[model samples]
Target: MSKSKILGSTLIIAGTTIGAGMLALPLASAGIGFSTSLLIMAVLWAVMAYTALIMIELHQHADSSATLHTLAKQILGKKGKWLASFAMLFLFYSLCAAYIAGGGAQFGDRLAQWFGVEVSATQGVVIFTMLVAGVVTIGTSTVDKVNRLLFTLKLIAMASVLMFLAPNVTQSYLLSMPLQQGLIVASIPVIFTSFGFHGSIPAIVRYLDGDTPSLRKAIVIGSAIPLIIYVFWQVVTLGVVNQSTLLENQGLSALIGTLSSTVSESNLAGTIGIFADLALLTSFLGVSLGLFEFLGDTLKKNSANRSQALNRSITGLITFLPPMCFALFYPQGFIMALGYAAIALAILAIFLPIVMVSKTRKLTTDVAYRVKGGHIGLATCFTCGVVIVCAQLLISAGVLPALG
Candidate 1:
């Protein structure tokens, strides 16, 4: 692959990881404070980045065309294939629902403010789904072009917001301690979600023709971009807004409204809005494209006689409809959806990678590039994933505290 394609694939990974989850960071980390959030983000980034390399390592032995499903069946057997399939669908659908819920709310607000037209959340969900679904149905090339354009705009808007908001940072706020116990534990699942670009690994592997050197570089650099962006984001957001204010903003819409109202620069508020919308849309396109292709492949197996165009259309509907309905009924499901996405991500990014890598290493010795740390490394990563899964479950069961 050429340098240009490498860069493009890198951007795809960064774009997918940095979307709706970024908006939830300040809110999720509010109770945990700035310093602790930084630590969690760093650890998760290391773990996730290592697992991504494990995935690339697996592809070294398998075909470039091999996806998570194919790899699971090849190495871990039928049960592993079923588990991998379920986790992929669950993770992708949960994320799609989140972006839809958050994106629709932002889209409706933009319309109401700019055109003086009132659009309900349900209507906004329909409009948002239709627009992105069209691009996805057209296929990956179209999604790539659209994602690049929006991702560029997202970066610019983010930089503009950071510049405008930097002067408002308070040292006292940055130094604040965790609001209550167990909040750090609760924030784990969401923090883990922010580093989730593992779903794009197989696609990246194929895009780079499974070139080990290039794939390794792409995964490391691509995942790192979001980590740096997220750290700076935490510093600026947590510094500008205190825990009390963050706690009061319950949902994405409320958080955006609060930021706009609290800031003195009118233009700053508008830029923040632009950044938020772009972030949501870019993330939406990356995720929906993956889900659309997965669904199309699954449908093709059952209906091989269907025309390609018709198959794509059906896949698009399956990809968006259930999530659209969920978004409409639960408009505030943005953060909650992300929490659930983390659970599925743990299974995909953490559990599957470790188990498959271990099994494959024992079964064959044809590996060119292997992740270090041996059995200890795999064991530690597995434990961390289990902790994240249990944390989310505990939070859901009311045994652990949740973010405001």
Candidate 2:
């Protein structure tokens, strides 16, 4: 359980969790009232953190090479594999769509600012997709190397945002949010989507060589980083942009677009653009790698031996194309895409962990770590998962404001 291993592992998880899902945070949570929204984020943070631990616990006790797909089959058999595969594929694809769409929006804005050229959203997506898909297909070793570098740029640019906006903050902006009573439920899906670090559990386990203690440490530290960043990010974004504006531009595109219009200073808008581009790229790399590896594992395309490692390029197409389609067609639906992703991820990340851990405890009765609170905690997690899934579905069905 070395600190360096834990740090690197933590970054991997943090990078995975803190991506496109967050691009819409201030926009999504602003209308909920900063006070009320923080509460929701904290609750979901606890729930997602607890679920991540269950996943780590399950990973530690299972086979050395087991992924969510394989582990699901070991506990629940072929049916489990099918359902798990579907959930995982859909979740990653939906996230890819959101990230690509957001990245394109940023790219288009940057191009206009730097080169005085305007690009259509579809053209922007096509350009951004070509760049990101190239990086993703170059393989995981390359992604890991590049992600660590861009991650630093993302932090510096973001820190500047807080610094610039912090001085202008007024008590009025912080307390001025209009809390919609019925609309609060919409934030849950976004929160769930934001705190999604479960997809990287397998990578953390393998990175730490399945050291349960180190894995546990990574889960807590990794999740905490994003939680803290989100709090500060939301505060600054709230203070910078008026609360009344978010209520109008619920979609990530509209919300972020509104930021440029509201901020009078060019540097402020420029810094926001730089931060968004760097953040989206790093997030794209981390999550896409996680999903790509998951797909490889499920396809049985990986190997412990270097020589046996299958270089199936088609997997790249399968993983990136669906998202590109969504990016091309629904370029403005960043929030909508994330809400749909939450629906799929809730089943995979939350519910599965509870069921698998319960079965693991009953069958083996041996593990280095176990999630506390027993059945009650698990029931709470399950119930919360159901609520989030239903919330996303209801929004998608037009029963509520389609917050996208």
User: Which candidate number would show the highest lDDT if scored against the true structure?
Assistant: 1
Tens digits of lDDT, candidate 1, 1-74:
79998899898788768787998998889888899999999999999999998998888878999989889999
Q: Output the TM-score of candidate 1.
A: 0.93
Number of clashing pairs per prediction, in order = 0, 1
Tens digits of lDDT, candidate 2, 331-382: 7777888889998889898888888898888987666677788999999989
Give the poorly placed runs of model 2, Cα more than 4 Å off.
Answer: 260-263, 266-268, 293-313
TM-score versus the correct structure, for each prediction? 0.93, 0.90
Least accurate 10 contiguous residues by lDDT in model 1: 259-268
